[model samples]
Target chain A: MLGIDDPLIWGVYILCILSMILCVVYGLINWNRGEEAEVQEIAEEEAWEEEEEKMQSEELGL
Target chain B: MDLMILNLVILVYLLATLYLGYRGWKATKDSEGYMVAGRKTHPYIMAMSYGATFISTSAIVGFGGTAAKFGMGLLWLTFLNIFVGIFIAFVIYGKATRKMGHNLNAMTFPELLGRRFESRFIQVASGLVIFLGMPLYASVVLIGAARFLETTLAINFDLALLVYSVIIAAYVIWGGLRGVMYTDAMQGTIMFLGMAVLLFETYSRLGGVTLAHQALTNMAPLVPADLAAMGHTGWTSMPVLGSPWWWTLVSTIVLGVGIGVLAMPQLVVRFMTVKSNRELNRGVLVGGIFILMMTGVAFAVGALSNVFFLNTRGMIATAVESNVDSIIPVYINATMPEWFIYVFMLTLLAAAMSTSSSQFHTQGTAIGRDIYETLTGQKGGRSILLTRIGVSTAVIMAVILGYYLPGNVIARGTAVFFGLCAAAFLPMYTLGLFWRRTTRAGASAGLIGGTLVTVFMYLFVHKAESAPLGIAKMVLGRDVLITQMPWPVVDPMLIALPISLVLTVLVSLITRPPPERHLDLCFRGMKKG
Candidate 1:
């Protein structure tokens, strides 16, 4: 039987598991962030447009 | 087994690769398209191309051969491959690279550095270094690929090298980056499948994974006297903590390649091929899984090869031919099911071609566009012609080098290149991307100082394989210059990396900071220039 007590074997297993978990989490978070940024981009564009309209009306004395 | 079936398979694979090259050529309309795949490559293609290019025949054939001698302790390299090569490369360095590259309108790696520091001299010098140094690395990959053919088919080594070089060069010269990436995706798939099958087959043949490990552990007492003298205890366990074998395993192979991926010009260029950070994010899982399969399988199977060899031939791996490099090839020839041989041969070809094409493309762009065009201020048709010439020239140089390299030198040769890159380029690369205050002078010093120190150490201090014209032997009547050092076998990277890192940080602190606009352009958030 193989020695289950060997640290080298366990070290490799743990590191591989950790790497997989990190990649999964990183991918999910970044994918969601990409979506959140798109929504924020639209919101920022609307706010800019509203500010631009207010300035135009005031300039024309509307 | 019939040669006709193998020939047909080879012909079909070549034709498909050439067709992809033709497609890439048709799609190209300008220098930008040729250089960076028009910067709109899909995530799957990007990830596959990156993984394939990153894990070459060197990783498979060379490292696999090493594992046959060294055992499963080599698996730590697999973890590093995933964590550093994929995770850090894509997550940590990927975004900044894409953003800064786009901001500077830089296509080549050297060009990106040049624009960041506002120095044409930096660009030209980097290109020269890459052109000169990369061939040595590429030649090892060539040898790894051709050695498979030589062992399997009894073909002449020179002929095998020449044929593979010509086929890869044709597509690279014709299609540019697009052709290279397109074919890399296809090649990457074959490699993934081949390794997965080999892993399962090896375990099944050995009865099971646990039994294989136990058997290998039982063979500890059988370790060669020479190897045991170097502190090797067994194939399953790590060598004695401070032994020369331990140091080489930990420093040269593990740490060297683990850190070196961050700075590789060929691999780094892959980041700029995508359109958005999301593409990089998308690549993470695919790349991770691909690496886990390719390297994890290779290491496991390579180590288990001892079981198969001892069972069948009653000989240990090194005893087969007295060459560690031949062990893997001999194992496959002896034990693999006959039907899988041709398919596996294609897998090796895939691994070799994907990496060689990328190397040739990177070398070509560095010379033709980065150095020649940057120096002469040339663009358009003339620049493309020069890049084609550069690709051809790199192929010739690599082929020549492959001819002369000693047997079993593939893994050692690869370590030399990887260690050199980590020592020479990693400090500058890391600070360049993240540290805004890094000045051109500091960067230049780090580049020159780090590379020269690495070369010097390899020649004078580290005497594992080959050194610079036997300088130490002639001068000191010893193979190594520094015999009294605490860690006699510590890799050059362990010494040279610290020197490079200190020089970069010390110089940057003392020198003038970069121009404000330059800093903003490189680091300022999310504004696609």
Candidate 2:
């Protein structure tokens, strides 16, 4: 086993644990934000597709 | 001993994967939905799926086994996984890819490149390359998971592999990308939890983190003479700089997989699934943590197992078995509680299944959508059916390759594919996304030149086993075509990537530029657009 007296080991462990915790917390906090973004994105995509369809019909003289 | 509890756990896990897969199938409405999850996947799911697909049993089991041999120096890969794979890949490449992919309405990675360059040849050639090359990787995942299962359940390796392959193929074929991502998310969660538990358990079992690492360091003298000669310092430190060990660790494993992640077709597709850049940004933290736990814990525990083995069995770490891949399985079976063994098995299954499913799906789409459709000018519903057929064919090929692959070749196989991708596709992929001056001839030359150099080196100069089973020796009367390079045997990517990059730039400089409209469509959101 490593030397327990070395503060570096403890620091490393603490950093890893804290990082993991921060990720979980941040992920949970921002989780719902993506859903809202998804809604807006879908709306924009549908609008884009509709525009594409209209342009295609115009090209075909429909 | 009764394994009723273990069987129950596995059954429940299988059912969960199947049910989630069915939901994906039900959710999918058309070819677009099947192919790209209708470009509206939840950010969390997309992030998790990307992480899961990027990692595999190859990373956990195969690479964990590698760490047992190499040591904590392997943690460099974990750092690369976070900084390059998650951060740069999602932040820098992911945005451009998603935007350009949206602009072109391209479903597959090859299709995206092909459309960007306005070349069906690029699409078809890339599709063929993926179909041909990816099964080797998928087979490695199958083998890595099977090895663990074989040890845990005391079952035949072939049986375990066959069962695993069938389960992954079923969902991937039926539900497509949606099913793959949904299952991948759940699997990624399980993988994260399992690695976390294993890390804590390993450190505690070895007394503590400090002691565990110290013990490994203290045993530096015990390293076998051959390894010592190769410049192994200790299990905790980097091997001697410029030594064979250092070169392999840095060039082959770390740089190979790290830079290679940017070019992976399967992982690249996940970016397109998310609805927006905001969703992609949301995925970054999740992917970072998931990669950390999965790879960080696996490497640490694999190295720490040396402490456990030495303290308990009075044996060196590598003495576990002849095959290095057996290290993780033996360590887990010997140390972990029976229940946790079952849990780890599920995690291994998830790692393998998630990666394999994506590989199958990507290869399938590459063939059906990129190659066949592009060549024939066919589109829409028939292509989806062809993709399903393509998925099945790839699965069958992967199983065949899995049955034949040599033991402990898992890590080597995974690295081979990653190195190939970095060398072959990374230059063109990055340039195509960012450089409007990138022409069709330039991209095609990069792909072909990069692939050829990597393949030629692998076959003739890089490694003996990389040759076609001693055909080089039989025909040429030597292991490699040219034996003497500056470094005796450098990693293929180190040699191939530069050549590919140079060729791409030179060819682009000489070739006439693509049409203005094509450049506008391809680079619509970027500065060049």
- Best candidate, DockQ-wise? 2
Instruction: Name the candidate that leads on lDDT.
Output: 2
Predictions' DockQ, in order = 0.14, 0.15
Model 2 Cα displacement at B121 (Å)? 1.2
Q: lDDT per prediction?
A: 0.77, 0.78
Compared with the true structure, what per-residue lDDT tens digits does model 1 show for residues B285-331?
78888888888888778888887888988867877766666677777
- List clashing residue pairs in candidate 2: A1-B211, A1-B215, A2-B210, A2-B211, A2-B212, A2-B214
Which candidate leads in TM-score?
1
Error (Å) of candidate 1 at residue B263 is 0.5
Candidate 2 C-alpha lDDT tens digits along B1-529: 2488888887888899789876765665443523245455667787887887788889988899898888877777877777778878877898889878877877678988899999999999889889998999988998888899888888888898888777777646544444356777888888888787788889887777777777777887778899988878778777877887888888888888878889999888767655666676678778878888988888888878888888888877788665777789888899878877897788788777767877987888787778878988976567666776788899999899998888878888888889888887889889989888888999999999999988877777775354556756777888777765425457889989999999988999899988998888777756663
Docking class of 1: incorrect
Off by over 4 Å in 2: A1-62, B15-42, B380-386, B464-468, B485-488
TM-score of each prediction: 0.89, 0.88
- The interface RMSD values of the models, given in order, are 12.3, 7.6
